[model samples]
Target: MNRKKLEALQGWSFISPALIVISIFVIGSIIFTIYISFHRVNLFTGYYEFIGLDNYKRLFNDTKVLIAFKNTLSFVAVVVPIQTFLAMVMASVLNAKIKGVKVFRIAYFLPTLTSSAALTMIFMFLFSLYGPINQIALQLNIINEPINFLNDAKVALKVIMSMNIWSTVPFFMVIYLAALQEVPEAIYEAARVDGATNVQQFFKITIPQLKPITTFVLLMGIIGTFQMFDQAYIFSNGSGGPENSTLTVALLSYRYAFGQNSTMGFAAAIALVLALLILVVSLIAQKLNKSDTLY
Candidate 1:
């Protein structure tokens, strides 16, 4: 046995446990999901009959699936950038050495650290028919009647979108705050001395310096929003609301997999499609970030 070969063997042995864990949880689950997608299975029986492309075909033809896809895409498209921009703005303002800065930072970040379940519950109360929101609107004479924030299909999705933004903003704000602190103060000072306005300094100096962190936050936001299930599930009581306006791919897959009408194969197929969608979005986000790099 050569000395170098023995050293290599020892290194592999040290990492073998972690590698095995990853393979079992990550790789094994992926392979199982793919395998099930190509089969016909259900909860009553463990029987998995080989049925290649059948699940995929049905998935594409399913109207509910299509709506879920559309809703998921629309939510991500509208939410991610808006949340990121808001976070950046908040982070920039907080970065300034203003009075009571620490208190302000804590106040802004409280929501990020709070439990999602609690936040969703509070939102439900706020959006209830005769809740504070409607009361205020009535007092202001904005409407002749109370609005059903989660019942109107036309506005249900938008309401969810707004809630999602509110829930996610504080998290991204923390990320942006950390990134902003890492940015060189000298660069912003120089830009200001060159007659650059605050907005210009932010655009030209802060943004460029924070590209790497911004890219990270963007990627995380996409993945998180893509798999958004908790808030909608809680707020809508897992029904996805009146007209399925708040239906999401993750929630749909969960419904199919373990809910009342469990179709294991179809559920697996949904999971596979969602995985592909996330992979494509992540790749595109990375590509766009890389292409637009200043450094």
Candidate 2:
């Protein structure tokens, strides 16, 4: 072969393994899921009876799907902004030349290292009736009685949201910290010379400088919160109980896919819907943040 053709062949050989694997696994799975989503699938029997758009039609009519979408939307809405803001603030604080800042950073980031399942359990304990949270409230007379956080429909989802925010903040905080390092100190210096306060510099200079990083963080947060499952599963014992307050789209999809009354086609449809939802929302968020132009 000619030298140019030989090099092209060699490059293709180097990438062929990854391409094969992705084609067989990722692309193959997506294609199969799409196929099943239009049918009634009986996996054990290798049966698929095509049913057109029935599954997608059911999505709009199903009350559980509605609840799941509501819960997931609320989750993404609340957790993304709060976690992004808290992560930025914590990153800024840790970036400061304060004593014991390393220790504080380590402590804050430790929660991110812990598994979501473990964190859910810990938060459940903390928010349980007569738990530390309730005890403290009782001692401070903030509540006349200890609140049942886990079983109450009103507070169950909120509890999960709080747990998600706490655990995720440290991860995004680290992202912000890394991005903060890239921000020019000279800009802050100029701001200071211009008699701008610390808060002013943070708002005007640091925030604008970290726009790309914030966009990344927001996208990650939205995707993660929308797909939240393990915590809700562990919290509600796979039932998404307490009036389905904690029922998320992922968990709902899993129930349809694997529950006693398995509906594999519906599950696949839900999964596809979730993927499209994430794509649309992430694109909108990216557009709003002008992340493409930030760089």
Q: How many residue pairs clash in each candidate?
A: 0, 0
Which 10-residue window in model 1 sums to the lowest lDDT? 286-295
- Best of the candidates, lDDT: 2
User: Judged by TM-score, which candidate is best?
Assistant: 2
What is the per-residue lDDT of model 2 for residues 1-295, given as tens digits with 9 covering 90 to 100?
8999999999999999999999999999999999999999868777789999999999999999999999999998889899999999999999988999999999999998999888888999999997999999999999999999999999999999999999999999999999888877888888899999989988987788888888889999999998999999999999996999999999999999998877899999999999998999888877877734332
Model 2 misplacement above 4 A: 286-295
